[model samples]
Target: MSGAVTSVFGIEPGDHAYLRYAGDDERRLLRAAHVTAAAGRGERAVFVDAGAWGGHDPRALPGGGQVFVLTPGEAGFAGGRLDVPRLMRVLDAQADEAARLGLRGLRVCVDLDEVLAVTPETAPRGDGGGPGRCPLAVLRGRSRPPAVICHGDRARLPEAILPALAERHPLTLDAATALTRHPLLCVRPVRDPAGLCLEGEIDDSNLGLLARALETAPLDGRDLRLYVRRLRFADVGAVRLLAHAADAMPDGHRLVLHAPGPVIKAVLRHYGWDRRLVLEEGDRG
Candidate 1:
């Protein structure tokens, strides 16, 4: 529910949150949070591939949000659904930590058991080597789903999430969605006449729109341009937008990108978009 303030995530015992994708990969809503927060908390990086259902390598991410199944000797439960009882155990363990971190209440959660049992290996999250027990440990946070159940009391579970729980794979949103819904800073350019101008930073809040623009929208063979006053060392949000922008562009479209500083230039160089996207002269007027 949009009215809900806090957030919570639930995952299977094997699925963990942090995962390290190659530099240019997108679709990292679940794992990216741990990574950015670790450095802020004076911690190192630890990647966990909570999405890997089949036999595949794990992604690098921060540590924590780890657990194991209750019955190792039991046969499988369902195709996609996790053993709800087992998941509740994992969530209960993390509940104290969640409380300490000052996380919002149950906003979102992911059922890793469903992700592994129901979804085929072909599913994006599942690294389909075979119909095997998911290697990736489960992880739960406040943002999206794939959350740990935290408790076995189904009756005690929030009534709001009942519908989500019924479905095999619940709808999982991300930070970008949160930002799009609620923004800290407003950055909209109003074009009336005379001189044209721009406003706002390529900040995390609006990065959701940028990603949506690139992933879902169609921009083929048309000319696309990003006019910025200046650029700086970008975050996962900014970098992801850039990558999505590049990937989502229509082949016929030529990119006309402009930046005002070397910080942005460094990022451009890192992603090697200079070749793919045409750089415009720095014009900060």
Candidate 2:
């Protein structure tokens, strides 16, 4: 891994960005940006070339740090069958090794266009399985999460999967402008009683992001109060996730939904979900 820091896809350490490039020039520019950002942060970088290498030289990258390259076949993958778990394990091990080597951190880049071409329609869920299984869901909220950039050829990637992929990432990069922005879904942790403050829309596409956030919340067996007053809308999937969280609460503990909007409340009532979870009307706790 190289210890060079430069900015690519407008991404920094502790952030994840998705980049959709148009051509080889754009791809190389973004790759250089990633290497530059990692080098500037004094971190090593790992580039996973999912078949887009095309004789590119890693040494030619601007970063002075070590750059580790992993081709698709060398990463224990063949065709559409993706061993996501094994891939994650390898990345985790690499991060540990980087830390041991006294590097500040690690940056990871994946060629999404190539990965998707070989990613089976029914890929292994690999720990993120449930009602809505997201294969790359495990990449979120790691203990020492590296700056991840999933690059793709916009014209070649499937349109249907774009929203799903974007929701899994907190930040996105516009290849044309190299700008980054966050999606609507936001999960903020409340400290006192250890609850969640959710805002924005929640539906099938991003429901797992909410579930992942709830799973990691520091409820500590206490009543889990969800402040969703700022939430604009939610679908049946969001309701299901909330109900699951409510059911997991211990005896004497409750799952409370504070200040849910009229539409949300009506949906909960219509499906009799209000009976399963507590619904508070106003600011009163």
Candidate that scores best on lDDT: 2
Q: Model 2: number of clashes?
A: 17
lDDT of 2 at 28: 75
Q: Give model 1's TM-score versus the native structure.
A: 0.30
> Using TM-score as the measure, which candidate wins?
2
Tell me the tens digit of each residue's lDDT in model 2 across 21-134.
Answer: 887778877766665555434467888785444576654644344467777665434464457667778877777776666555678887766654423333222332322333
On a 0 to 100 scale, what is the lDDT of residue 267 in model 2?
Answer: 53
